[model samples]
Target: MQDITFKHTLPVQLRFNDIDALGHVNNSVYFTFYDLGKARYFEEVKRSPINWNDADLVIANVNANFLSPVFMSESIAVQTATLSIGNKSLKVVQRIINTDTKEVKATCETILVGFDVATSSAKEISVEWKEAISFYEGRELCK
Candidate 1:
């Protein structure tokens, strides 16, 4: 925990469809929010040259921890950071928190793997990708 260093933040609003019968945002909605956060992180923070489809990386694994329920009425912001980078995979940690009261709604850590677009197999994490991520994280990352 200890508030992982956040590299990017994007505000999100819950839609009507995001809510379940219990009046809380459904579990699947977190994925969308995190995806947006990831996109924004790469675009604005990392400023990478790769697009989602053209990138050499792909999500290989994910582990999410839901601390509290998010409501449609509250304002939330998704925080993203590079958790770790490996030979063929990178780990990113994200958090969605209420902006007004600063309450954590959800947390997710995802592992993205580098792959050959044509061959569709895992490849080494590119040096450019590693440098881009490190620059955004604002510190030396754990190898």
Candidate 2:
């Protein structure tokens, strides 16, 4: 595995509905947290709000690992970083960590593919999008 330095983090608020019968956060809810992190990361990186009507990126794959249970009382945040970029897709990695102890509770990797909504087909990622992400990551990502 390559070393990843997360440049974006969003604190997540715990809600009562997030807890399951086991008194910990539900496994399914972790994806929601990751989604929130991704949304904020892109917004900050692009310096603008995303327009869903013109959105060209869609999730192609996702893999998650639940490392530990998160209690309702714990302070947690999600960290996100771009792992790599390809012609039509980019890979991202995220992790949920306890703010106090810095222990990771869950981790996820996702691949997002460029899509042409009008034609309903895959498309090459735009150069502008690539440049914005590369600038934010402080490294060259295009490959």
Candidate 3:
């Protein structure tokens, strides 16, 4: 994981509701941090506003590993990067980290497919999207 470089990071705001009875952040809340990172990454890379009503991509799957517990006293951030792009889908990876300590609290990988809401079907990844991501990452991606 240390070899992978992330170009985007979004600070996560902790809310009282995010905590559980165990006195730590609830596991489910990490997804929201990843969502924030994803949204910001797309907004920067695509250089276009994302319309959720007609989102360009839809999450097909998400896998996360909780490395450590997050307490309310710690400041956190989510780092994101595009892992790979396929013909009709892409993989994104994110890490939730303690900002001050630089300790990763959780890591996640999400698979997303280009989607068409009108038809409720998958679509091929656009050349523009691939280009944008590649340009942002400063490397060639997608086979």
Candidate 4:
């Protein structure tokens, strides 16, 4: 894996309901944290809120690795970074870590594809979106 310097980080609040009978956060709950991280990253990087009703990006695939158990008492945060941008898709990586100890608890990689909801098909990513990401990442993502 390539070393990634995450520029976006969001603190996650754990709810009691997130814990399973095993006294740790359920595996399913980790996905929710990753989702939240992605949302915030886009909003911040784009410098505006996303209108879900007219959103053009959709997740194509996701892969996650759970490195350690997250206890409810742990102070955790999610960090996100864009790995690369293609003509029609972008690769994103996110990790959840303990705020105090900085131990990574879980990591996720996702591919988001640009889609035209009206046509129900994939579309090329917009230049504006690409520029926004490139500027926020502090590096050229387009190849």
TM-scores of the candidates are 0.92, 0.97, 0.96, 0.98
Model 4: residue 112 alpha-carbon error in angstroms: 0.3
Candidate ranking under lDDT, highest first, comes to 2, 4, 3, 1
**Where does candidate 1 have its weakest 10-residue lDDT segment?**
44-53
How does candidate 4 score on lDDT? Answer: 0.94
- In candidate 3, which residue pairs get closer than 3 Å at backbone N, Cα or C atoms, i.e. clash? none
- Per-residue CA lDDT of model 4 for 24-96, tens digit only, reads 9999999999999999999998889998888889999999999999999999999999999999999999999
TM-score attained by model 4: 0.98
TM-score result, candidate 1: 0.92
User: Which pairs clash (backbone N, Cα, C closer than 3 Å) in model 2?
Assistant: none
Give lDDT tens digits, candidate 1, residues 56-140.
Answer: 7778888888999998889999998887888888888899999999888889988988889989899998887788778778776
What's the CA error at residue 39 for candidate 4, in Å?
Answer: 0.7
Q: TM-score order of candidates, best first?
A: 4, 2, 3, 1
Runs of candidate 2 exceeding 4 Å displacement: none
Instruction: Put down candidate 3 lDDT per residue, 112-135, tens digits, no spaces.
Output: 999888999999988989999999
Clashes of each: 0, 0, 0, 0
lDDT of 2 by residue, 1-143 (tens): 25789999999999999999999999999999999999999999899999878889999999999999999999999999988899999999999999999998999999999999999999998998899999999999988
Model 1 whole-model lDDT (C-alpha atoms): 0.84
